[model samples]
Target: MLLDTHMHTHFSGDSNADPAAMARSAIEKNLAGICITDHLDYDYPDEPDLFTIDFPQYEKGIRQLQADFSDSLNINFGIELGLQPHLAKKHHEILQEMDFDFVIGSSHVVHGLDPYYPAYYEGRSEHAAYLEYFESILENIAAFHEFDVYGHIDYVVRYGPEKNKNYSYDKYKDVIDEILRQLIAHGKGIELNMAGFKYGLGHPNPTEEILHRYRELGGEIITIGADGHAPDQIAWDFDKVPQLLKAAGFDYFTVFTKRKPEFLPV
Candidate 1:
Protein backbone atom coordinates (compact mmCIF):
# COMPACT_ATOMS: atom_id res chain seq x y z
CA MET A 1 0.00 0.00 0.00
CA LEU A 2 1.17 3.56 -0.76
CA LEU A 3 0.92 6.49 1.65
CA ASP A 4 1.88 10.10 0.98
CA THR A 5 2.06 12.09 4.21
CA HIS A 6 3.01 15.47 2.78
CA MET A 7 0.91 17.39 0.24
CA HIS A 8 -0.55 20.81 -0.47
CA THR A 9 -3.88 22.05 -1.84
CA HIS A 10 -5.44 25.30 -3.11
CA PHE A 11 -5.63 26.42 0.49
CA SER A 12 -1.95 27.14 0.11
CA GLY A 13 -1.37 30.27 -1.97
CA ASP A 14 1.20 28.64 -4.22
CA SER A 15 -1.16 25.82 -5.18
CA ASN A 16 -4.30 25.88 -7.31
CA ALA A 17 -5.50 22.33 -6.62
CA ASP A 18 -8.33 21.74 -4.20
CA PRO A 19 -8.78 18.93 -1.66
CA ALA A 20 -11.33 16.92 -3.65
CA ALA A 21 -9.32 17.21 -6.86
CA MET A 22 -6.20 16.07 -4.99
CA ALA A 23 -8.18 13.15 -3.54
CA ARG A 24 -9.50 12.24 -7.00
CA SER A 25 -5.96 12.17 -8.34
CA ALA A 26 -4.73 10.02 -5.48
CA ILE A 27 -7.62 7.60 -5.93
CA GLU A 28 -6.92 7.38 -9.66
CA LYS A 29 -3.32 6.53 -8.88
CA ASN A 30 -4.53 3.83 -6.46
CA LEU A 31 -2.77 5.35 -3.45
CA ALA A 32 -3.90 3.91 -0.14
CA GLY A 33 -3.92 7.30 1.62
CA ILE A 34 -2.76 10.94 1.46
CA CYS A 35 -2.59 13.92 3.82
CA ILE A 36 -3.30 17.50 2.78
CA THR A 37 -0.60 19.56 4.56
CA ASP A 38 -1.50 23.05 3.45
CA HIS A 39 1.01 25.82 4.11
CA LEU A 40 0.63 27.66 7.41
CA ASP A 41 3.64 29.92 7.18
CA TYR A 42 3.46 33.00 9.33
CA ASP A 43 5.58 36.17 9.25
CA TYR A 44 7.33 35.41 5.97
CA PRO A 45 8.71 38.73 4.69
CA ASP A 46 8.45 38.44 0.90
CA GLU A 47 5.23 36.52 0.95
CA PRO A 48 4.70 37.83 4.51
CA ASP A 49 1.13 36.60 4.69
CA LEU A 50 1.30 34.67 1.48
CA PHE A 51 0.66 30.90 1.25
CA THR A 52 -1.06 30.76 4.63
CA ILE A 53 -4.32 28.77 4.82
CA ASP A 54 -7.39 29.22 6.93
CA PHE A 55 -7.40 26.24 9.25
CA PRO A 56 -11.19 26.01 9.54
CA GLN A 57 -11.72 26.08 5.78
CA TYR A 58 -8.89 23.62 5.28
CA GLU A 59 -10.38 21.20 7.79
CA LYS A 60 -13.83 21.49 6.23
CA GLY A 61 -12.53 20.72 2.76
CA ILE A 62 -10.60 17.74 4.09
CA ARG A 63 -13.63 16.42 5.91
CA GLN A 64 -15.68 16.72 2.75
CA LEU A 65 -13.11 14.82 0.77
CA GLN A 66 -12.83 12.16 3.46
CA ALA A 67 -16.57 11.50 3.25
CA ASP A 68 -16.76 11.72 -0.55
CA PHE A 69 -13.89 9.32 -1.13
CA SER A 70 -14.29 7.10 1.93
CA ASP A 71 -14.91 4.01 -0.14
CA SER A 72 -11.80 4.36 -2.31
CA LEU A 73 -9.11 6.14 -0.28
CA ASN A 74 -8.30 7.54 3.13
CA ILE A 75 -7.93 11.34 3.23
CA ASN A 76 -5.98 12.77 6.12
CA PHE A 77 -5.93 16.41 7.27
CA GLY A 78 -2.61 17.96 8.18
CA ILE A 79 -0.78 21.31 8.32
CA GLU A 80 2.81 22.30 7.59
CA LEU A 81 3.77 25.07 10.02
CA GLY A 82 6.78 27.23 9.31
CA LEU A 83 8.86 27.31 12.49
CA GLN A 84 10.40 30.61 13.53
CA PRO A 85 12.31 30.53 16.82
CA HIS A 86 10.63 33.59 18.31
CA LEU A 87 7.11 32.48 17.44
CA ALA A 88 7.06 29.19 19.28
CA LYS A 89 4.34 30.22 21.75
CA LYS A 90 2.06 31.55 19.03
CA HIS A 91 2.74 28.53 16.84
CA HIS A 92 1.79 26.22 19.67
CA GLU A 93 -1.41 28.15 20.35
CA ILE A 94 -2.46 28.08 16.71
CA LEU A 95 -1.80 24.36 16.47
CA GLN A 96 -3.76 23.70 19.66
CA GLU A 97 -6.89 25.22 18.15
CA MET A 98 -6.86 22.85 15.21
CA ASP A 99 -7.61 19.15 15.03
CA PHE A 100 -5.18 17.81 12.45
CA ASP A 101 -4.08 14.25 11.97
CA PHE A 102 -0.47 15.22 11.37
CA VAL A 103 1.70 18.29 11.83
CA ILE A 104 4.90 18.82 9.80
CA GLY A 105 7.30 21.40 11.21
CA SER A 106 9.52 22.92 8.53
CA SER A 107 12.13 25.66 8.25
CA HIS A 108 11.43 27.67 5.10
CA VAL A 109 12.92 30.92 6.23
CA VAL A 110 16.47 31.44 7.45
CA HIS A 111 17.25 34.67 9.28
CA GLY A 112 14.03 36.16 7.86
CA LEU A 113 14.96 35.27 4.26
CA ASP A 114 13.15 32.60 2.33
CA PRO A 115 15.92 30.54 0.71
CA TYR A 116 13.72 30.07 -2.36
CA TYR A 117 14.59 33.64 -3.30
CA PRO A 118 17.71 34.06 -5.43
CA ALA A 119 19.20 36.80 -3.29
CA TYR A 120 19.48 34.61 -0.19
CA TYR A 121 22.64 33.08 -1.57
CA GLU A 122 23.79 35.84 -3.90
CA GLY A 123 27.32 36.40 -2.57
CA ARG A 124 27.78 33.66 -0.02
CA SER A 125 29.76 30.48 -0.52
CA GLU A 126 27.76 27.27 -0.67
CA HIS A 127 29.44 26.13 2.53
CA ALA A 128 28.38 29.24 4.40
CA ALA A 129 24.80 28.93 3.26
CA TYR A 130 24.67 25.22 4.03
CA LEU A 131 26.11 25.67 7.48
CA GLU A 132 23.68 28.50 8.20
CA TYR A 133 20.78 26.39 6.97
CA PHE A 134 21.78 23.49 9.20
CA GLU A 135 22.15 25.78 12.18
CA SER A 136 18.75 27.28 11.53
CA ILE A 137 17.15 23.82 11.42
CA LEU A 138 18.74 22.96 14.75
CA GLU A 139 17.28 26.10 16.27
CA ASN A 140 13.84 25.63 14.69
CA ILE A 141 13.49 22.02 15.78
CA ALA A 142 14.68 22.82 19.24
CA ALA A 143 12.10 25.56 19.64
CA PHE A 144 9.03 23.85 18.29
CA HIS A 145 7.30 20.99 20.13
CA GLU A 146 3.93 21.04 18.41
CA PHE A 147 4.93 18.99 15.39
CA ASP A 148 4.92 15.25 14.81
CA VAL A 149 7.72 15.23 12.22
CA TYR A 150 10.43 17.46 10.79
CA GLY A 151 10.01 18.06 7.05
CA HIS A 152 12.82 18.09 4.47
CA ILE A 153 15.91 18.20 6.68
CA ASP A 154 18.08 19.32 3.77
CA TYR A 155 15.55 21.28 1.73
CA VAL A 156 17.80 24.32 1.31
CA VAL A 157 20.09 22.34 -0.97
CA ARG A 158 17.50 22.25 -3.74
CA TYR A 159 17.43 26.05 -4.06
CA GLY A 160 21.11 26.49 -3.36
CA PRO A 161 22.94 28.11 -6.30
CA GLU A 162 25.88 25.71 -6.09
CA LYS A 163 25.63 21.97 -5.81
CA ASN A 164 26.72 20.76 -2.38
CA LYS A 165 29.28 18.36 -3.85
CA ASN A 166 31.22 18.32 -0.58
CA TYR A 167 28.13 17.97 1.57
CA SER A 168 28.17 14.69 3.45
CA TYR A 169 27.53 13.33 6.92
CA ASP A 170 31.22 13.13 7.63
CA LYS A 171 31.69 16.80 6.77
CA TYR A 172 28.80 17.88 8.94
CA LYS A 173 28.58 14.94 11.30
CA ASP A 174 28.41 17.05 14.43
CA VAL A 175 25.48 19.11 13.19
CA ILE A 176 23.64 16.13 11.74
CA ASP A 177 24.23 14.20 14.93
CA GLU A 178 22.81 17.00 17.06
CA ILE A 179 19.72 17.23 14.84
CA LEU A 180 19.08 13.49 15.04
CA ARG A 181 19.72 13.41 18.78
CA GLN A 182 17.19 16.18 19.28
CA LEU A 183 14.59 14.43 17.10
CA ILE A 184 15.05 11.21 19.05
CA ALA A 185 15.02 13.01 22.36
CA HIS A 186 11.78 14.73 21.48
CA GLY A 187 10.24 11.58 20.03
CA LYS A 188 9.70 13.11 16.61
CA GLY A 189 10.10 11.45 13.22
CA ILE A 190 11.98 12.79 10.21
CA GLU A 191 10.35 12.66 6.81
CA LEU A 192 11.95 11.07 3.76
CA ASN A 193 10.93 13.73 1.25
CA MET A 194 11.09 12.33 -2.32
CA ALA A 195 10.66 15.73 -3.97
CA GLY A 196 14.46 15.81 -4.05
CA PHE A 197 14.33 13.46 -7.03
CA LYS A 198 11.86 15.71 -8.85
CA TYR A 199 14.32 18.57 -8.43
CA GLY A 200 16.83 16.78 -10.69
CA LEU A 201 19.01 16.23 -7.66
CA GLY A 202 20.58 12.77 -7.29
CA HIS A 203 19.74 12.39 -3.62
CA PRO A 204 16.61 12.39 -1.55
CA ASN A 205 16.32 15.21 0.97
CA PRO A 206 18.91 14.43 3.71
CA THR A 207 20.51 11.80 1.38
CA GLU A 208 21.22 8.14 2.15
CA GLU A 209 24.17 8.75 4.43
CA ILE A 210 22.11 10.97 6.71
CA LEU A 211 19.39 8.31 6.79
CA HIS A 212 21.91 5.67 7.84
CA ARG A 213 23.25 7.95 10.53
CA TYR A 214 19.75 8.51 11.86
CA ARG A 215 19.44 4.75 12.26
CA GLU A 216 22.85 4.48 13.88
CA LEU A 217 21.90 7.18 16.36
CA GLY A 218 19.03 5.03 17.59
CA GLY A 219 16.39 7.04 15.75
CA GLU A 220 13.31 5.24 14.52
CA ILE A 221 9.93 6.44 13.22
CA ILE A 222 10.89 7.68 9.77
CA THR A 223 8.02 8.71 7.51
CA ILE A 224 7.97 8.89 3.71
CA GLY A 225 6.33 11.58 1.59
CA ALA A 226 6.18 12.68 -2.03
CA ASP A 227 5.78 16.34 -0.99
CA GLY A 228 3.38 16.55 -3.94
CA HIS A 229 1.57 19.78 -4.75
CA ALA A 230 -0.53 18.34 -7.57
CA PRO A 231 -2.36 15.10 -8.27
CA ASP A 232 0.05 13.47 -10.73
CA GLN A 233 2.76 13.85 -8.10
CA ILE A 234 0.92 11.80 -5.54
CA ALA A 235 3.02 8.82 -4.41
CA TRP A 236 5.56 9.72 -7.06
CA ASP A 237 8.54 7.36 -7.32
CA PHE A 238 7.12 5.28 -4.48
CA ASP A 239 8.50 2.05 -5.95
CA LYS A 240 11.99 3.07 -4.83
CA VAL A 241 10.90 4.06 -1.31
CA PRO A 242 10.89 0.62 0.30
CA GLN A 243 14.36 -0.20 -0.89
CA LEU A 244 15.60 3.20 0.23
CA LEU A 245 14.20 2.69 3.75
CA LYS A 246 15.58 -0.83 3.97
CA ALA A 247 18.99 0.42 2.91
CA ALA A 248 18.77 3.03 5.65
CA GLY A 249 18.20 0.17 8.15
CA PHE A 250 14.56 1.00 8.67
CA ASP A 251 12.56 -2.22 8.80
CA TYR A 252 9.19 -0.48 8.52
CA PHE A 253 7.48 2.60 7.04
CA THR A 254 5.04 4.63 9.09
CA VAL A 255 1.42 5.65 8.55
CA PHE A 256 -0.68 7.97 10.74
CA THR A 257 -4.33 8.06 11.67
CA LYS A 258 -5.65 10.49 14.28
CA ARG A 259 -2.02 11.54 14.66
CA LYS A 260 -0.96 8.06 15.74
CA PRO A 261 1.68 6.04 13.88
CA GLU A 262 0.94 2.60 12.45
CA PHE A 263 4.02 0.71 11.27
CA LEU A 264 4.05 -1.37 8.09
CA PRO A 265 6.97 -3.62 7.17
CA VAL A 266 9.27 -2.31 4.53
Candidate 2:
Protein backbone atom coordinates (compact mmCIF):
# COMPACT_ATOMS: atom_id res chain seq x y z
CA MET A 1 0.00 0.00 0.00
CA LEU A 2 1.71 3.18 -1.20
CA LEU A 3 0.83 6.56 0.28
CA ASP A 4 1.85 9.72 -1.59
CA THR A 5 2.05 12.40 1.10
CA HIS A 6 3.05 15.33 -1.09
CA MET A 7 1.07 16.67 -4.04
CA HIS A 8 -0.62 19.84 -5.18
CA THR A 9 -4.06 20.69 -6.52
CA HIS A 10 -5.55 23.82 -8.08
CA PHE A 11 -5.74 25.48 -4.69
CA SER A 12 -2.04 26.01 -5.07
CA GLY A 13 -1.33 29.07 -7.16
CA ASP A 14 1.09 27.31 -9.52
CA SER A 15 -0.79 24.11 -10.11
CA ASN A 16 -4.00 23.46 -12.05
CA ALA A 17 -4.62 19.87 -11.04
CA ASP A 18 -8.01 19.31 -9.46
CA PRO A 19 -8.31 17.45 -6.14
CA ALA A 20 -10.82 14.85 -7.32
CA ALA A 21 -8.83 14.17 -10.46
CA MET A 22 -5.60 13.79 -8.51
CA ALA A 23 -7.31 11.36 -6.19
CA ARG A 24 -8.56 9.32 -9.11
CA SER A 25 -5.07 9.19 -10.55
CA ALA A 26 -3.80 7.84 -7.25
CA ILE A 27 -6.41 5.10 -7.25
CA GLU A 28 -5.58 4.23 -10.83
CA LYS A 29 -1.97 3.74 -9.84
CA ASN A 30 -3.03 1.40 -7.01
CA LEU A 31 -1.95 3.81 -4.33
CA ALA A 32 -3.50 3.33 -0.94
CA GLY A 33 -3.68 7.05 -0.17
CA ILE A 34 -2.61 10.57 -1.13
CA CYS A 35 -2.41 13.90 0.65
CA ILE A 36 -3.40 17.05 -1.19
CA THR A 37 -0.68 19.34 0.15
CA ASP A 38 -1.34 22.43 -1.90
CA HIS A 39 1.13 25.32 -1.74
CA LEU A 40 0.58 28.23 0.65
CA ASP A 41 3.71 30.29 0.21
CA TYR A 42 2.78 33.46 2.00
CA ASP A 43 4.50 36.70 0.94
CA TYR A 44 5.83 35.01 -2.16
CA PRO A 45 8.29 36.97 -4.21
CA ASP A 46 6.96 39.25 -6.98
CA GLU A 47 3.59 37.50 -7.46
CA PRO A 48 2.51 37.18 -3.85
CA ASP A 49 -1.08 36.40 -4.83
CA LEU A 50 0.03 33.46 -6.90
CA PHE A 51 1.21 31.35 -3.96
CA THR A 52 -1.49 32.04 -1.43
CA ILE A 53 -4.80 30.23 -0.89
CA ASP A 54 -8.10 30.79 0.90
CA PHE A 55 -7.93 28.29 3.76
CA PRO A 56 -11.65 28.10 4.39
CA GLN A 57 -12.48 27.51 0.73
CA TYR A 58 -9.56 25.12 0.32
CA GLU A 59 -10.65 23.11 3.34
CA LYS A 60 -14.24 22.94 2.14
CA GLY A 61 -13.16 21.57 -1.24
CA ILE A 62 -10.88 18.99 0.37
CA ARG A 63 -13.61 17.81 2.72
CA GLN A 64 -15.98 17.35 -0.18
CA LEU A 65 -13.37 15.37 -2.08
CA GLN A 66 -12.67 13.15 0.91
CA ALA A 67 -16.31 12.19 1.12
CA ASP A 68 -16.54 11.69 -2.62
CA PHE A 69 -13.50 9.42 -2.76
CA SER A 70 -13.96 7.64 0.54
CA ASP A 71 -14.37 4.20 -0.99
CA SER A 72 -11.65 4.56 -3.59
CA LEU A 73 -8.68 5.74 -1.53
CA ASN A 74 -7.61 7.46 1.66
CA ILE A 75 -7.62 11.18 1.00
CA ASN A 76 -5.77 13.51 3.33
CA PHE A 77 -5.96 17.29 3.37
CA GLY A 78 -2.60 18.94 3.92
CA ILE A 79 -0.78 22.15 3.18
CA GLU A 80 2.76 22.92 2.03
CA LEU A 81 3.75 26.13 3.80
CA GLY A 82 6.70 28.16 2.58
CA LEU A 83 8.72 28.82 5.72
CA GLN A 84 10.33 32.20 6.42
CA PRO A 85 11.70 33.13 9.81
CA HIS A 86 9.89 36.43 9.81
CA LEU A 87 6.57 34.68 9.22
CA ALA A 88 6.97 32.22 12.10
CA LYS A 89 4.28 33.80 14.23
CA LYS A 90 1.88 34.16 11.33
CA HIS A 91 2.40 30.54 10.33
CA HIS A 92 1.87 29.36 13.89
CA GLU A 93 -1.38 31.28 14.14
CA ILE A 94 -2.60 29.86 10.85
CA LEU A 95 -1.70 26.30 11.82
CA GLN A 96 -3.64 26.72 15.00
CA GLU A 97 -6.70 27.82 13.05
CA MET A 98 -6.72 24.87 10.66
CA ASP A 99 -7.05 21.14 11.19
CA PHE A 100 -4.90 19.71 8.44
CA ASP A 101 -3.84 16.08 8.46
CA PHE A 102 -0.26 17.00 7.52
CA VAL A 103 1.92 20.02 6.89
CA ILE A 104 5.18 20.39 4.92
CA GLY A 105 7.44 23.31 5.69
CA SER A 106 9.66 24.43 2.81
CA SER A 107 12.01 27.27 2.03
CA HIS A 108 11.11 28.55 -1.40
CA VAL A 109 12.64 31.96 -1.07
CA VAL A 110 15.81 33.08 0.66
CA HIS A 111 16.71 36.68 1.45
CA GLY A 112 13.54 37.87 -0.24
CA LEU A 113 14.47 36.02 -3.45
CA ASP A 114 13.46 32.75 -5.01
CA PRO A 115 16.23 30.68 -6.52
CA TYR A 116 13.82 29.64 -9.24
CA TYR A 117 14.30 33.05 -10.82
CA PRO A 118 17.55 33.78 -12.67
CA ALA A 119 17.85 37.07 -10.81
CA TYR A 120 18.50 35.18 -7.61
CA TYR A 121 21.53 33.49 -9.14
CA GLU A 122 22.71 36.37 -11.32
CA GLY A 123 25.49 37.87 -9.20
CA ARG A 124 26.45 34.83 -7.15
CA SER A 125 28.42 31.71 -7.81
CA GLU A 126 26.42 28.48 -7.73
CA HIS A 127 28.08 27.45 -4.46
CA ALA A 128 27.22 30.74 -2.77
CA ALA A 129 23.59 30.64 -3.90
CA TYR A 130 23.17 27.04 -2.79
CA LEU A 131 24.87 27.72 0.54
CA GLU A 132 22.60 30.69 1.26
CA TYR A 133 19.57 28.58 0.46
CA PHE A 134 20.66 25.94 2.97
CA GLU A 135 21.44 28.59 5.55
CA SER A 136 17.99 30.05 5.10
CA ILE A 137 16.43 26.61 5.55
CA LEU A 138 18.30 26.02 8.80
CA GLU A 139 17.17 29.39 10.11
CA ASN A 140 13.55 28.92 9.12
CA ILE A 141 13.28 25.45 10.69
CA ALA A 142 14.88 26.83 13.82
CA ALA A 143 12.25 29.54 13.99
CA PHE A 144 9.14 27.58 13.02
CA HIS A 145 8.02 24.48 14.91
CA GLU A 146 4.46 24.16 13.62
CA PHE A 147 5.26 21.98 10.63
CA ASP A 148 5.54 18.22 10.42
CA VAL A 149 8.36 17.77 7.89
CA TYR A 150 10.65 19.85 5.72
CA GLY A 151 9.89 19.60 2.03
CA HIS A 152 12.56 19.44 -0.71
CA ILE A 153 15.67 20.42 1.30
CA ASP A 154 17.70 20.89 -1.92
CA TYR A 155 14.91 22.13 -4.18
CA VAL A 156 17.01 25.00 -5.41
CA VAL A 157 19.22 22.58 -7.31
CA ARG A 158 16.42 21.95 -9.79
CA TYR A 159 16.75 25.44 -11.25
CA GLY A 160 20.51 25.81 -11.06
CA PRO A 161 22.30 26.45 -14.35
CA GLU A 162 24.38 23.32 -13.97
CA LYS A 163 21.52 21.42 -12.38
CA ASN A 164 23.13 18.62 -10.33
CA LYS A 165 26.31 18.44 -12.39
CA ASN A 166 28.68 19.65 -9.63
CA TYR A 167 26.44 19.16 -6.61
CA SER A 168 27.17 16.58 -3.90
CA TYR A 169 26.31 16.04 -0.28
CA ASP A 170 30.00 16.28 0.68
CA LYS A 171 30.18 19.85 -0.57
CA TYR A 172 27.68 21.15 2.00
CA LYS A 173 27.67 18.42 4.58
CA ASP A 174 28.18 20.77 7.50
CA VAL A 175 25.09 22.91 6.96
CA ILE A 176 23.02 19.99 5.77
CA ASP A 177 23.93 18.02 8.88
CA GLU A 178 22.96 20.97 11.02
CA ILE A 179 19.59 21.18 9.27
CA LEU A 180 18.98 17.47 9.87
CA ARG A 181 20.09 17.72 13.48
CA GLN A 182 17.76 20.62 14.08
CA LEU A 183 14.77 18.83 12.57
CA ILE A 184 15.54 15.69 14.54
CA ALA A 185 15.91 17.61 17.77
CA HIS A 186 12.58 19.33 17.15
CA GLY A 187 10.84 16.00 16.44
CA LYS A 188 10.41 16.93 12.82
CA GLY A 189 10.91 14.79 9.71
CA ILE A 190 11.84 15.08 6.01
CA GLU A 191 10.39 13.82 2.78
CA LEU A 192 11.94 12.00 -0.18
CA ASN A 193 10.49 13.96 -3.09
CA MET A 194 10.43 11.91 -6.30
CA ALA A 195 10.10 15.09 -8.33
CA GLY A 196 13.88 15.03 -8.59
CA PHE A 197 13.49 12.39 -11.29
CA LYS A 198 10.91 14.55 -13.02
CA TYR A 199 13.58 17.27 -13.04
CA GLY A 200 15.98 14.73 -14.63
CA LEU A 201 18.24 14.29 -11.60
CA GLY A 202 17.58 10.52 -11.45
CA HIS A 203 17.35 10.79 -7.66
CA PRO A 204 15.13 12.22 -4.95
CA ASN A 205 15.57 15.67 -3.47
CA PRO A 206 18.29 15.78 -0.73
CA THR A 207 19.95 12.94 -2.69
CA GLU A 208 21.06 9.53 -1.43
CA GLU A 209 23.90 10.61 0.84
CA ILE A 210 21.75 13.10 2.74
CA LEU A 211 19.09 10.45 3.28
CA HIS A 212 21.70 8.04 4.59
CA ARG A 213 23.16 10.66 6.88
CA TYR A 214 19.70 11.51 8.23
CA ARG A 215 19.21 7.87 9.16
CA GLU A 216 22.65 7.73 10.77
CA LEU A 217 21.69 10.75 12.89
CA GLY A 218 18.73 8.76 14.26
CA GLY A 219 16.23 10.60 12.11
CA GLU A 220 13.63 7.92 11.72
CA ILE A 221 10.61 9.83 10.46
CA ILE A 222 10.72 9.92 6.66
CA THR A 223 7.94 10.18 4.07
CA ILE A 224 7.98 9.75 0.30
CA GLY A 225 6.21 12.14 -2.05
CA ALA A 226 6.13 12.71 -5.79
CA ASP A 227 5.54 16.45 -5.32
CA GLY A 228 3.09 15.79 -8.09
CA HIS A 229 1.40 18.93 -9.39
CA ALA A 230 -0.68 17.13 -12.00
CA PRO A 231 -2.39 13.81 -12.46
CA ASP A 232 0.32 12.19 -14.56
CA GLN A 233 2.94 12.95 -11.94
CA ILE A 234 1.34 11.01 -9.09
CA ALA A 235 3.53 8.25 -7.68
CA TRP A 236 6.34 9.29 -10.00
CA ASP A 237 9.24 6.81 -9.73
CA PHE A 238 7.62 5.15 -6.69
CA ASP A 239 8.47 1.61 -7.80
CA LYS A 240 12.11 2.47 -7.17
CA VAL A 241 11.58 4.20 -3.82
CA PRO A 242 11.66 1.10 -1.60
CA GLN A 243 15.12 0.24 -2.89
CA LEU A 244 16.29 3.75 -2.24
CA LEU A 245 14.92 3.64 1.30
CA LYS A 246 16.63 0.30 1.93
CA ALA A 247 19.89 1.62 0.52
CA ALA A 248 19.63 4.53 2.94
CA GLY A 249 19.08 2.08 5.84
CA PHE A 250 15.41 2.94 6.29
CA ASP A 251 13.37 -0.18 6.83
CA TYR A 252 10.12 1.79 7.02
CA PHE A 253 8.48 4.87 5.58
CA THR A 254 6.08 7.29 7.33
CA VAL A 255 2.45 8.27 6.89
CA PHE A 256 0.45 10.85 8.83
CA THR A 257 -3.08 10.74 10.16
CA LYS A 258 -4.41 13.67 12.14
CA ARG A 259 -0.85 14.99 12.35
CA LYS A 260 0.44 11.78 13.92
CA PRO A 261 2.89 9.48 12.16
CA GLU A 262 2.50 5.77 11.44
CA PHE A 263 5.47 3.78 10.21
CA LEU A 264 5.05 1.32 7.38
CA PRO A 265 7.66 -1.34 6.62
CA VAL A 266 9.52 -0.73 3.40
TM-score of 1: 0.96
lDDT of 2 at 120: 87
Clashes of each: 0, 0
Q: lDDT tens digits, residues 98-210, model 2?
A: 99999999989898999898988898799999999999998898788789999999999999888889999999999999999999999999999999999999789979999
- Candidate 2: TM-score? 0.99
Error of 2 at 58 (Å): 0.5
Superposed by TM-score, candidate 2 places the C-alpha of residue 3 at a distance from the truth, in angstroms, of 0.6
Tens-digit lDDT track of model 1 for 1-266? 77888998889877887678788888777778888898888898766779677777777888988898889888788888888899899888986788888889998988988888887887878778888888998898878867888898888888887655666668777887899899989888888999888887777887888888888888888888988888887777888888899999998988777778888877
Error of 1 at 164 (Å): 3.8
The window of 10 residues in a row where model 1 has the poorest summed lDDT is 162-171
Stretches of candidate 1 above 4 Å error? none
Displacement of residue 31 (Cα, Å) in model 1 is: 1.4
